[model samples]
Target chain A: MTLEVADLQVHYRTLKGDVRALDGVSFSLADGEIVGLAGESGCGKTTLGKSLIRLDGRMRHVGGTAVLDGDELPIGDDKAMNARRWKEVSIIPQYSMSALNPTRKIGKMIAELLRARGKSYREFKDELVRRLELVGLTEKVLDNYPIELSGGMKQRVVMVLSTLLDPSLLIADEVTSALDVTNQRAVAETLVRFRDMGFVKSMIVVTHDLSLVYQIADTIMVMYAGRIVEKAPAETIIKSPKHPYTRALIGALPEVGLEYGDERLQSIPGKPPHLLNPPTGCRFRARCPLASEECEAEPPTVTVEAGHEVSCWKAN
Target chain B: MGRYFRRKLLIYGLTFVIAVSINFAVPRLMPGDPVARMLTRNSVANVESSEAMRGYFNELFGLDVPLWQQYFNYWGALFRGDLGVSVFAFPSPVATVVADALPYTLALLLPSILLSWFVGNALGAMAARNKLLDNGALPIGYVLTAVPYMWLAILLAWVGGIILGWFPVAGGYSFALTPAFTWTFIVDLVHHWFLPFLSLFVVALGGWAIGMRNLVIYELESDYSNYLQALGAPNRLVRRYAFRNAVLPQITGLALQLGVVVGGALVTEVVFAYPGLGSLLLNAISSQDFFLLQGILLFIVIGVLVFNFLADVVYVLVDPRTRLGLEGGQS
Candidate 1:
């Protein structure tokens, strides 16, 4: 395994109480494996990605252990975790448009960034230029300011910059969310190419768009509220999901070539439960169709297949 | 480029016409005969010879000419940089009085403006990085911003001058030191200027600090900052990147402030008795020195317009998103 996460529980501090954003998420990614984290908004997908690298002021790492390349990640302590970030684990944020500095020329910004990591730009300039070329950007772009580049170009520039150090794990947080379909496909393919080229060993692509993830991810994990309700191979998860929440969520998506009028798609009926003083038992119990007295107590994660996992009494 | 320049020229023309017209019309519409007011302090003494005073005022104030003709003459004289003679300061043109005061105001205003921006921005960046610093500094900054300039000026004068007796109370320089171009004289000038500059610095620094802090907070929450963080760029890199982007909006604001610095520091200058444009304008108004007031207002209006135009050009340079021709070319 290249990455292992065990019983990760992260919460956000609020005026009322602690909001459990990421509750007991456990998973492992094999070498070269690409996992797609599919969920609705506020489903702890982002929290999981953020926790793997750095936690912001509001996010408190209550309890969790993430092992990257058999080394324990010191995620909770920002200073301790600094050693692993960028060089080991990296992320391509959602909006790459405004990511670059507007004042400095692209080359100067990149040089300054490299120098910050204690590396001289002179040594890496060749490789950086080659990567830029691979991304279909010319050397002239380096001379131009960030505003000179188009949105898609900026996203690609950020992509190359993120993987410049060849991190062990890359967390691409909604990287394609802001792109047009064509640009999205291009960027997605570029990510796959990066993995194939050994720039990054394993990856987690977080998005609400299940179909897009279905096209890219080798395995898919579905999360509802703050917990991972289902995890399986991409084909298995898409064809036959065991968890009720996953089923409802998959059923909700309007797949390409499937018109709305052909078969009316239904959205999840109820909103995700508020995490502040969340219900005792299962967090999704309120919206689950299989809710029963047994669900009053939290259901343990059950492994029905060699690699597949589902946390539900019915799945067991 | 041509279109942009033409648009700017159009704006400048409109501003110049409106500002000059207002400057001309306002003085003419004032109730008291400025000539009579110039001649005698009491209105009763001038009232007995009001008709003769009106004729003298017509000749002296250019009211003898037809309104439209006078407007043209004023406009012509303005283009020629020949603002009419001051009523109170006999034989001296309004332009001469303003020119004499300009260097003093610029000297105080420029340094204070630069210092405020530099210190405030640095403090803002520091506050953004450390939550403890932000929490501690926020209230102090707010109090400073909210406190009126006049009040702060008085407080500083009382504390720094009267109580501590650490600095000079008033005036731009010492009477013992003769004015010269030598470094010694310059150093002495600066030493005396310390109190006035410090007073203005405190009053203005607060706004810059608060404005920058809020901007940085917004930048910190932005996707770019998070992206930079994910890139494992050090805290310093993240700060520089965030501050650079966040400070773009403030550049224009600072430039606007710079243009109006002459007119804007009225209260600060008045309280400190600084011989700057603000004090000059104050004296002009009290004496009903119409020409001087018109000249100063016109200078300020032109200064504001020019600075605002420079700010726009800067905006284009800083963020290419504002540049024309390329709209939504990005995906």
Candidate 2:
């Protein structure tokens, strides 16, 4: 495994109380694997991605251990994590359009960042130019300001910059949500190409578009409130999801060849529960059609096959 | 860039034309007649002689002509670099009067306006992230900004001039000395200039500090700053970028605040009795010296416009986004 996250609990510190954004979540990524983490807007998938690399100010790492390549990550300590960031682990944040400094030239900003990190920009210049070209960009973009580039160009530039150091793990957070369908497909394919080229060992693609992530992810992990409801191969998760939440989630998507002339598409009956002071037992119990008294207690992660696991009482 | 500057110059030229026209019209529209006021100051009581003097004075000042002709003459004299003669200080040309007062005002205005902007932005940027400085300095800044220019001038005068006797409260220089290029006169000029400058500086400092603090905080929280921090760029590097970006808005703010600062300086000069354009303006208004008033107002208008133009140029140089907008062809 390239990354192993076990019993991770991250909380959001608010004036009201500590919001259990990520409560006892656990997952692992294999070498060269790209895992698509999918869920609704507040499902804590972004939190999971951020926690692995850099937790924001409001997020507190209550309990967790993320071991990468047999070395424990200092997830809670910012100073300790700084040494490993960008070089060991990096993130392609959601706001790639405005990620660059508008005042500084792209090449100069990159050089300054490199200098601060004790790396020589001149040494990396040729490789950087190659990667920019790989993403269908010219080296002339480095001389231009961020404002001069189109949104798609800026997005591609950010992609090249994030993986420039060949980090072991990359977290691409909703990177495709802002792009059009064609650009979205191109970006997703570019991510796979990066992996194939050994630019990144593994990646967690956190997104809400199930159909989109299904195209490139090796394995899909479906999360409900703050916990993963199912983990299976991409084909199995899309074709035969064991968890009701995952099934309903996949059911909501409109397929290419389907006709909905007579019947309307189905949506889940209720929204996910509020993470702050969440109800005891299964998080999806309130919204699950198959909910029963057995679901009042927490369901264990039961293995259906060698690699497939489902956290549901009816999965047995 | 050439087209952009040409357009700016065209706008400024139009503004000048409109402003000069208004400057000519305002004093004429006022209730008092400057020639009659001049007569009263001379204490010419006899009706026959007063009437003779009025006719001679009006003809001499070119006021005896028709209103349209007078307006043309006014513009004609302006183009010839003549500001006409002051009714308040008879026989002295308005240009000479204004010229005499110009240096004192410039000396007081330049250092105060620039130093406040620089020092305030630095302090505000520093205090944005430091809790102790923010808590301590922000409230003081608020209080300082809330204090009116004249009120603060009076307060400084009372404390530094009356209570302590550390500095002179009035005049551009000591009355005991003659005007000269010697060190003693220069020292006395500065000593008298200090209180008025301080009053303008203190009030403006507060406004700039408050503006910069808020701007820096916003920039630090911007997506670019967050991206840098997430990439593990050191705090210093991130803050340096934030400060640079934050200063862009403050430049525009400086342009917007320039008129207000100039107005404050005017009030400050009046309160301190400093021999600057403000005091000259007050005398012109009270004595109904139309030519002197017009001359002083024209200088102020031109000063404001030139400074605003300089700000636009500086903004274009510092912000690439604005530069792109100016070029108008790029994405």
lDDT of 1 by residue, B158-205 (tens): 898889998777776777878789998898778767878888887677
By summed lDDT, the worst window of 10 consecutive residues in model 2 chain A runs over: A258-267
Q: Which residue pairs clash within candidate 1?
A: A151-B330
Name model 2 segments beyond 4 Å from true: B256-264
Model 1 lDDT per residue over A171-196, tens place: 99999999999999998889889999
What DockQ, between 0 and 1, does each candidate earn?
Answer: 0.50, 0.77
- iRMSD of prediction 2: 1.1
Candidate 2 lDDT over A19-77, as tens digits, reads 99999889999999999999998999999999988889899999979999899999999
**Best candidate (score: TM-score):** 2
DockQ of 1: 0.50
lDDT of each: 0.84, 0.90
